[model samples]
Target: MNTLLKRQLLRGLLLAACLPGVAMAASIQALNYSSREVDYIAVENPGNTNSGGGGDSIRPYGQGGSICCFSVPEKWHADLKVVVVYQLSPDPTFHRETVSVPQYPDGKSGDIWLIVYEDGSVGAVVSLYGPSRPEWPGKIKGYPVPTKEYRDERRKEKIKREKAVLHSMENALDGDVSDLTPVELMRLKGAIEYSKKLINILEENDK
Candidate 1:
């Protein structure tokens, strides 16, 4: 799980209780269930690494081992998923460094996010600090913030989708006029004409 996915999964789970569809009872159930699940996974040194020849991770969440934060499906099922693909990270110290096993081989203390899917695809992230860990853990606060580059990329995709829709509509206008009601036909034609005129005006202004 990258930063964006981590933040999103947590934020969604945290807000699940408040979402419209899920009943308040279910939300409360799920929230409590998730908390317990998190505690279960987090132990005093889940495992240790000796690559750097140090030892297994001895840091409990607050001190003994890593906090080891991760998420489960809102339903808390053994097989519920939330994404196409996801990856859990090792430790926050490794993000900036190489992935050598023996390099700083100590358990990490941070967050993990796992988004599982019905199809078995997943997305996940693990890190040391909140920022490096892909996302924060708050709904009101910033959790699933996309990077500037990611935002720009999404904007481009939106523009492309809009253009595709416009092109399809323009093509439909030339295809059939028989099935459409009079009012519908009139609106479609007017929209097409107005768009063409707008394009012409813009071109003229540019010239």
Candidate 2:
């Protein structure tokens, strides 16, 4: 499964436990039931390829097998199972790398990242070494961080999503208000108002 879907499933499972007035006994019962239902699907490695092949940056290099990491679902920590399917290379030396995987907080995808090279040395990097963001792993003590590209990209995406939501609300509002039912109109109006509030907060934070 892809990262996003894995997160959604985990979040849903967690929400059920964190709800208000959930008694300890009730929570345990629910958790036990949920644990039995959760299962892990091994990620399929993207086929090996060369750097010159296709996947520009994020895409797996053609020469190396792709590694996708996933977190265990909440409540299933005791029964968590990890399965890896090995792909053999033409040369024995170009074999799959064995990684020491760590248990990540349930639901985060890729807490364990595998590094594969055509030369056959496989290494595993834990995101814990870095901050919550994997792209910005922990600093090298006093060494300066070369760039903030990842943070900038995150800001850009937040802006993009906000704009899209605002645009959609505006379009909905521009449609016939006369024909709109009271509930539908209220929903659209609330969305527009929420978008305005979000924009204001973002602008304030930017300043």
Candidate 3:
């Protein structure tokens, strides 16, 4: 083969090899509409961990940033399925569910959305658009709305954390601090005051 022809053939082969990887890559995003915070979400094909992706905690009524590079076929197939494994906050157990991949319209590929519902059921949809877009396929519309239960739980957790901080600060103040530099002593006193103020605010809100 001539040099130019040989170069052209080599380039064509490289393009062919690269195309499939580009086509197969996709991202996973979580939309937590549930009353509980989502601790984590992992998406994989049944018994196949190599080709999947996952993301960390998303607060109730919040959307998680995208986690990249899960495999999705360029062409949609009827038999396609992904296993979703996730956990909700305050719940020690992890849940797993097998979900069928929805068909993409017009052969379009998009990110996989894992929807966590208020009733604790999880659903998956493949969409090129996010919840803000009209093309979104999830049943609930717009951003998630936190239920009363969720709000109450959040408040309680916040108060608990603040109380712990106040207790720690109080204990430190009670200890011998004669060795602390004047600047350090002032900062410590300021932190204790801040902690007291936060605890007071949380307590008032609880009433």
Candidate 4:
């Protein structure tokens, strides 16, 4: 081949070799906000803000419970949007809104949420409802929603965590309360109470 032909061929080969790596290097920008999944809460606007019901009517399928999805306020409907946050990725002190763990049953959404907590820990919430097997934009309509299967997995994991915590607290209770400092005793008591509450919730769901 002539000099120019050889140069062109070599360039083409190099470009082909780098194509796969370049593709792999690109990160998925789907805005998949999650926890360990992080404890992400789906705030209507932000980690805090208007997530709590401010009189907005039930969303798309409000009949099935808000977990299925909720609609944006009418004021913002013309340009309404549901931002699927991935994380705080910033200082919590500067934030005005907060992400709280939603109450049982209602909190589940197969979709991923990104938010920060008071302590600055990133929180992610997986749908414990939505759909059983969702396919993307098709499965979701006005707003993003998770599938039932995803929620089931999260529910199980939550139950496991709660049980583990309960076990530890129960074991601690077996020890002498006299040895614990006042503060330590107070925290232990609080944890025991919280753990039991969580256990009760999970058990109730099972029934």
Per-model lDDT: 0.32, 0.38, 0.75, 0.40
Q: Judging by lDDT against the true structure, name the best candidate.
A: 3
For model 3, how does the per-residue alpha-carbon lDDT over 1-207 read when each residue is reduced to its tens digit?
Answer: 666434434543443356563354566788888767799887766886543567458987888887654656667778878888889888878888898877774457788788888888888877787778776767776878777776777888998998888788778879988898999989989998887888788778777
* Candidate 1 lDDT, 24-92, residue by residue in tens: 111100011010111211111112221111011211111113221233222222232222111112322
Which candidate model has the greater lDDT, 3 or 4? 3
TM-score of each candidate structure, all chains considered together? 0.30, 0.34, 0.66, 0.34
User: What residue runs in model 2 are displaced by over 4 Å at the alpha carbon?
Assistant: 1-122, 125-148
| Backbone clash count for every predicted candidate, in the order shown | 24, 7, 0, 24
Expressed as tens digits, the lDDT of each residue in 104-147 for candidate 2 is 43323333333333333333333333333445322222212223
After superposition, the stretches of candidate 3 with alpha carbons farther than 4 Å from their true spots are 1-24, 37-39, 46-51, 55-61, 73-80, 87-95, 102-107, 171-177
Better of 1 and 3 by lDDT: 3
Which of 2 and 4 is the better model by lDDT? 4
Error of 2 at 11 (Å): 31
lDDT of 4 by residue, 1-207 (tens): 666434433443444354442111110112221222222233343433433221111211121122322222212112223334333323232223333433323322233233332243433233334323343222222333444555667688889988887888888888777889999989988989988887788877865
* Residue 19 in model 1: lDDT: 46
